[model samples]
Target: MAALMIQGCGSDVGKSVLVAGLCRLFANQGLSVRPFKPQNMSNNAAVTVDGGEIGRAQALQAIACRTPASVDMNPVLLKPQSDVGAQLVVRGKMAGTWQARGYQERKAALLDVVLESFRALQAQSDLVIVEGAGSPAETNLRAGDIANMGFARAAQVPVVLVGDIDRGHVIAALVGAHAVLEPADRDMIAGFLINKFRGDPSLFDDGRAEIAARTGWADLGMAPWLAAARRLPAEDAVVLDRAGPGRARRVRIVAPMFPRIANFDDFDPLRAEPQVDFGFVPPGSPLPGDADLVILPGTKATLADLAFLRAQGWDIDLAAHVRRGGRVLGVCGGFQMLGRAISDPEGVEGPAGAAPGLGLLDVETVLTGDKVLRPTTGRLVSGAAFAGYEIHVGRTLGPDLQRPLLICDDGAGEGAVSADGRIAGAYVHGLFDRAEARAALLAQLGAASDGLDQHARVDAALDEIAAVLQQSFDIPRLAAIAGLEQRP
Candidate 1:
């Protein structure tokens, strides 16, 4: 099997999307392709067929390859709970939580684990497209780094550096990386990719040549700013701050942006709705007074974020929104925060303590060591069929559950509904993925549904992006670099 690693000049340089597009391109050629990331640090995750979780991006890549996602795809996942620490997941299971410095010290030991997963994928596929985490220029972390250069050299995988030209200074970013990387690390980069270029492709010929001349790395190709990217769910949280088009719409839906927000992908379908205007209200900002619906998004640490919500006076705004007859839906961790209280005696998330919740629903949650990871399908209480997944680490129970929001396929009730039916919550993420469910919920607000099929849209987008990559980059050269054509 042959493999090629895509490392970025920095995070958000379209590394994940590139790997995914490459996977699809090869798969179209009838090659058995697989994707692997040595390490990932994102709260936006996808439950795997193996009953574990990996970065949602990897799961998307697996879908592009037409394969079921496996834990071997992403062996090391760091889920941040706060600025200084994170809960570390290894091989699709929680290992433990560690501070930043502490993790740095411990990560060296994980190289073995990372390589094992990489070898596992390599054994099963004709081609394995590997993705690196963040930039390697942060060389101080280079000593024990398993995410970038360290993993690259260990696996003996040739690298193609990706630079985001849209961020400007494309010349410097590429040349600068060449300057900063150690000789050994620098040697691994066989070529460089210029991403998100706009306007005439010929305009950057000189620029690409300059980079190639200076760095002695081949110019793999320049990819234009792709429209298909918007259709995919972003793994980075920064996308939440993007300003809307200011277009008029029939309904406005807003969600408070929590510091530790998890699974923000849950909102992508709603954001795509034609009649809905959706946005994330940043911390310290008031929940839109005119909103038809306010969402409390899932977070990594429910108690901590719940406290932050109160500190931001969102508790008061939520009260006002409820008073204004606005509808509210809490999801997963957010659902826990909507209950009467949250208890974490084992400190599964943070300090062993209890805190009062927004009390929108008559329920309570207790943090536990066990995390639930399962894909579920059922019908909403509104009688609309829905399909989604569950990924969480708490158990909730109370009176509001008596008026359960939906019944599962096994006839067990899931989620809770308040007495007025204006407030609802569930541990299930992606509850709005199903068009019928989204339609049913929007209908309650007197809005019309556009009947969007998310799966089809995403698949079409993958096709579009793969086509773009095929035309933009020299596939034969890339394949030769990976020795893909040489051997097979």
Candidate 2:
């Protein structure tokens, strides 16, 4: 099987979206195109049909290609559990936790497994478009690198270098990549693509020519900023901007931005409501004074981020906010923080094994070495049955266990909630996507509420984007580039 790989000049230069676009572009031309990434690092993850987790970006690409996601689509994933340590996922399952130096030293051993996944994808699909992580030009980290050039060499796939024109230095970045690559790696590159061009692409004719002339590489074409891109799901750890279409409300939910924040998508549905406003405050900014609600999102490191929150005077402010009749909602690690105490005697998150919590809820949490992964269906405090998923490993207990906040069918029981309703916390993510649940919460806050079918809306948006790709992109050319053109 033959393929073309998309490698970026640097991180966040739109490699994921390009892979998604190409998948749709190729699939529209009567070809079966599958997306592949040897490795990915993100807190946003999705469970596959095989009941294993992979980064959400690959899942998005799979959706764009109109294919079901599987472990073979993404063989390796790294979820940052701490500043220096990552939870390594191989073949869609947990391999183990490893620190930076240790993982880098042993990375080469995983190349065989990655290549095996690529081989499986190649066998089934007419064209496989592989995506590279970060820049291939990072000479220092090239050793045992199975992500970019190494994966290309092993898979025998030609590469297309993509540079961000909006970032400036498009020519220098492209030229610099060719300069840094070893001769063998340089030969793997088929050409380059200038991505995210804001204005008319014709204006960059001279720049494109210069890049091609300087690097001796082909220029595929410049891609304009696709407005429909927002319709696509984001697969990065960064929180989505929460400032659109939502009306101002008295019951504001202020979420503090923890450094290694995970599962921030917990708040996405709320941002769509006309009667609710959710504000995400980064570390330096003060928590809103007059807000009716404050939320603590999940963190990879519970104890370390708890310390960071207190350092920024958020601890004292949180207490004051509760006194001022503000509601606080915490999810997962945040739920652990709202309890009386959190214990990590095994040093699961860091060297320190223990930390004092905000004590807003009567619960206590103990960190465990193992992670839990399952889809959960439960009843909310308002008695509305909800469906969501849980992917954490913190055991919690509280005095008010009799009144379950979330009654899971798996006997995982319920989360903690304050009796007075001033504070609440749950382990499940995406609970608010349920219209009845969101309306119940908003009703409690005295905000006007309306039900919007989020899942249906998102599906419609994805279909619209696929149609746009069908209309605008050079589908046949992309299919030919991906080696999907069959001889008559």
Candidate 3:
């Protein structure tokens, strides 16, 4: 079995997208390729085929390879709930919450499991493409690191370092990484890749050559800015509460930003709509008065983000929006926030306590240890069939549930709708992933539906990206680096 790992100089350097594109490129060549990440830290997660949760980025990579996402793809997942602490998941199940310092001390022990997972994927596939989290430049974390160089050396996998040229100082970033890394770690990097290059590639020829000359790492080649990547769901943590470029369209849809928001990609389908004006209302910004629909996205810490919402005075804005006959919809933690109350006696999200909700829906939720991680198929009350997943920790009950906004295929009611039908909440994430659901929700808002199939669009984007990589990068070098035959 052959394996290659991709590590970046820093976070948000387009590491995830590079791995995804490579996965598709290799898969298109009739080679069985699987993506692996030893560790990933993100609140955006996806339910796997085996009733587990993995980073959404890995899930996207699985799609690029046209395979089912599995927990083994991402052995260790971290969902940040605060600045200094995160909830840990081991092989797709919650392990526990740990502070930054605490996790740093204990993470070394996880290397065995990480290698075990990687070995399993290698046994099943001809080639496994691995992705690293954060950067090995932060050598301070290198003692117990399983995410980057530590894992690469242990697994004996060659590394390709990727630097984002779009962020400027590509030369410094590449050479700086070489200067800072330990001698052994430096040797693990077999080559260097420059990503997100705009303008003329020839303009940076000397710059790339300078880095190769200084560091003596093979040049894997530069990749142009991939516009096709935008079609894929957001993977970087920076995108959690990122605001959209405000442009007025026929339908105005808005979502309040939360510090610990989870699965915000739930709104990607709506944001992609041509007739929709969508943005995330940042902490200080008030919710738009003209918004036709206000969406409350899922969160990792329900009670905490509920407090964050109120501290931003979003509750008042939501109340006013509803008073103006505007629509409101909440998913997962956001759904729990729209109800009458949220109780967390076990302190699963922090100090055990309860928080009053927006009272927009007649429902009460209590945090529980039982986390729902399953793929679901159901239809909206508006007669649209949809496929989605539920990944949250809470049990909700109330009279509003009797007027469910959705009916599951198993004959179970999901979500709640207010008496006037202007307010609704659901525990499901990615409900709008399907074109049918998007059309139904758009029609309900009195907006035109383009009826674009999201699945097909993403698939096409994958193909486009694979074709781009095939032409832009030195695929022959990449193939030989993996000890595989060059492309025929």
| 10 residues in a row with least lDDT, candidate 1 | 239-248
Model 2 accuracy (lDDT, Cα): 0.80
Pairs of residues at least 3 apart in sequence or in different chains that clash in candidate 1? none
lDDT of 3 at 25: 92
The deviation in Å at residue 367 for candidate 3 is 0.2
Candidates' TM-scores? 0.98, 0.91, 0.99
> If the candidates were sorted by their lDDT against the true structure, best first, what order would they fall in?
1, 3, 2
Q: Given candidate 2, what's the lDDT at residue 39?
A: 88
User: TM-score ranking from best to worst?
Assistant: 3, 1, 2
TM value for model 3:
0.99
Compared with the true structure, what per-residue lDDT tens digits does model 2 show for residues 15-88? 88888877776676667878999988887776676667777788778877888888888899988877789888
lDDT of each: 0.91, 0.80, 0.91
Model 1 misplacement above 4 A: 486-488
Pick by TM-score: 1 or 3, better one = 3
Candidate that scores best on TM-score? 3
